[model samples]
Target: MWKYIKWGFRITVLIIVAAFLHYTLPQRDIVRITGTYNRLTEVGANSIFYASPDSGTTTNTVDRRDIRFIEAVYPDGGPMVYRNEDTGWIWPPYFKYDSSNLQAEATNAISPKDKPEWVAVTHYGWRLPIFSIYPNAVKIKAVAGPDVRLIPWVNIVVLVLLGLLVLMLWRMWAQFKERMIEPAMDDLNNTLDAVDARADAARDRARGFWGRLFGRK
Candidate 1:
């Protein structure tokens, strides 16, 4: 029926909107964070410390001195944090000098003003503190790490596929209504109308006789 077809189209549109939000919003940061700790008897001055507040209960802490800081923050908020205690390094959580224009959130718990203390000393990873704090240090002049960008051409491809799917569903639904449901409903409606007409006529023809029988009219 036309009613069913209209309902299906509405449902399809709702699904498309949901899918778009799922694919494009709240995107994850793609920059990778890494560093090297001392292989032998460790010196305290060489290790690095990093942290990420949004990483939930589980966070990453590494001992790499060259960890990318601005790359993680700018453009996308960030995935990781970097710190170098030995170098007296303190960087801004929002001040990204990288290609991505990520800055510290205005409402973030960790801000530039609340400079977090460094935890890991190069000499011993075992002495790391248990406090949750944002890193105040960053690697400067850092380029953006590789990210999977949304290409217009790829979008075109996706749109084409979505169009084809819509067209296919439309054709199939039209055929189903035409072949299976519409003719049956039409027949039922016509039969009901005829029955109604016959009942009206019968009532009209017998009404005067009944009235006169009841009251000498």
Candidate 2:
């Protein structure tokens, strides 16, 4: 039971870590830009996903703000819309203050439905339409075709660094146990043993004196 519980806890932790990385890391989507426009969208309960007030371009007073939208379609004819917004100096740390430039590039890359020009959009975050949350596009570049493969170097490098960090922390903990904790415990045990020996010796001498005085064993 204990073994199963331990395994379950470990699996849960691994799942949580994987989910966090998936949400935080940048992903590339090979898409064909159909249109680019701005809409005055209301920021409400789902404001956490949107850009903050300090993003420099958007106003913070009103609930409605002009949100730049990039309408696109996937290779398999799936519609995917992305919102181009400044990420500011917080959160995911994109520090992206070039939403206008990215929007212009995306607009230039737009092609007709018959002759679709594939573009790679680098972005982070999820697009949940139900919650009115769209992925903020950090950058967009025109690609050769829709079939162009993108290797996720960011994810690879990040995972490698994280693995190294975990290994380093484990090594540090092991060294602490071996060098500091174990030696201190050994000293404590030795001192306890010496005290026990002295106590036994004192008791033996007292018993001998009492036995000799009373003429007992």
Candidate with top TM-score is: 2
User: In terms of TM-score, how similar is model 2 to the real structure?
Assistant: 0.79
Q: How many backbone clashes does candidate 1 have?
A: 12
What are the per-residue Cα lDDT tens digits for candidate 2 across 1-217?
Answer: 9999999999999999988888779999999999999988899898888888778557745677889999999999999999999988988889999899998999899999888889999998898989988988998988899889899998899999999999999999999999999999999999999999999999999999998989963
lDDT of 1: 0.39
Residue-level lDDT tens digits of model 1 in 1-217: 9999999999999998766533332223233333222111222343223322222112233322222222123234334443322222232122323212222321122323133211111111121334422233322222233344423453467668888998999999999999889998999999999999999989987896798788874
**Cα lDDT, model 1, residue 123:** 14
Q: How close is candidate 1 to the true structure, as a TM-score?
A: 0.38
